[model samples]
Target: MIMPQQSSKNSGLWQQATLLPIALVAIEILVINGGMILDMTTSGTSDATRVLLMDSPHWFLLTGLVLGASEILAYRFLVKRFAKRPVTELGATGCIKETALGILVGSVLVSLPMLILWARGFWRFNSFAINSGILKGIGIGLIACVFEELLMRGVFLRLLEQKWGAPGALVVTSLVFGAIHLSNPGVTWLGALTIGVEAGFLLGTAYLWKRRLWFPIGLHFGWNAMQAAFWGGNVSGTGKQSGLLDGTLHGPTWLTGGSVGIEGSLLTAVIGLLAAGVIWKLTPREAPEMAPHEAKTPTDEVPDTGETPAITASEPGRQTRRD
Candidate 1:
């Protein structure tokens, strides 16, 4: 069908603004349906019940990976065609560093909260084990981190910030992030709120600080991975799986997080805010004054002197122009 025409600026702006939510919904549908098909065909489930109850990790990984690729392709298309921007700034080296820092920051933020609970005698160690589930869990974490960050931080936050500025975007995205988890099996209002205040702002802030998805993705992956793989905790009310450590909670549901995991606890909020503050402070500040000092063009960088304006060992007393 033919579409209404719009100015170039408005067209680009709208495309940059709204494509993320569309992409999110599209990916979810594709992943869910694709997983169902794989499960039904491979698991010999001839009925709807089996499809709905599908839990095979193989199908999950296959669907997640395929859809993850699709999401990236979609992102590239939007960025190049509609947004009219280069994808080069998503530098490989920078992504790795940001992701690693995110993981480290997330690990510390999440662990500290749980550790506080443990210190208060709200948690206990019950058992310990490791299995193939850990790999599956990691795969799930990877997919979740990449996709969620792409949607929430990379796209949603960017658009929102453009329209509403940082504070508005931060709150909106954070609340949305928490709201999505409300459908989790045992999530309570308080739990969801805690998630909003803690993870929502924390991850969004991580993205805002670095202006890259990798950092938030790493933070997200590390947070879920630690909760699932390391602690064997129920993530967002999902039942716990085999992890490196099998543990138990022993205090009020509010303090220990009951089955919803430590993310539902009060301590998480405090630590999350602290981590966000640290990340905000650590981000490199832009040297705005350097902009005016830069050469107007490549040719303007040098003088007629035999030597370029660049300082060198041979010109000990000579000074280079600041620009």
Candidate 2:
């Protein structure tokens, strides 16, 4: 008849750490609008002026880089306080294998619907053209992964970990990811719920398996970039200005993803399930290590791993936040 209490160290002050990328996106878009001023300041009407102002490619890459830096800032200044891992565990090399596995895992996940639709003869292919080319499309995909994984797994999930524990963290963070995509041109409830659970399970599984940001990040990037840029199609809800397989979406809403985007298709659902299964298998049976006062596993008990920030860490937690 004992109630569980979260460790003081497991309680965090790292709120809003996960929204850095979105914030950066907003700022970047605003800056793009500001380019009109840059245009007027320079020569009034010319190709160069147009290039500087109306270029989405340059702006897209720039925004990705800026957002990435902001994400790093959040990690060092805020998110670290909520982690249950050490500095070494968060290193780029720490989860290299896991990241690679995550990419493969996501590809397999998207394949389920691919096979079914392919069998039904509903999947189609098309040609595309873009100034960014294949490399940019691919690079952009990888960038998307970094932005998403950093926010969800790297920052937000850990916040929940500090409170309700790992499973709770998974559910909350996963739903948020899916819910955020609701605005994609024509989103549907079935599609959103399917993606919410499927993506949540897969990404959460990767967090458990890799124990760092790299894996989930790479997976996110690979899936979307490949789906849109290389293969050519609508991503979640957005039609990417892509390279390679640039084509129009055709077929029924059930097969193609319709106006709501590719993630809405049953094909995506099937693939997502497969990927989730693979990652689940790869993930170890070990529960996420939390503080002692936080909760105890049936196994051996240890002191606060010191992974998260202290609830009263106004002083000390600030140090960890900056660390």
RMSD of each: 9.1, 10.7
Error of 2 at 8 (Å): 5.2
TM-scores of all predicted structures: 0.78, 0.71
Q: Give candidate 1's TM-score.
A: 0.78
lDDT string, candidate 1, 222-253, tens digits: 89877877877788788776678777877787
lDDT of residue 215 for candidate 2 = 72
**Which digits, one per residue and each the tens of the lDDT, describe model 2 over residues 175-258?**
888888787766677767666876766777677675666677667766766675666656766655566765555688876777
Off by over 4 Å in 1: 1-6, 39-54, 284-323
Assess candidate 1 and give its lDDT. 0.73
Best by lDDT: 1
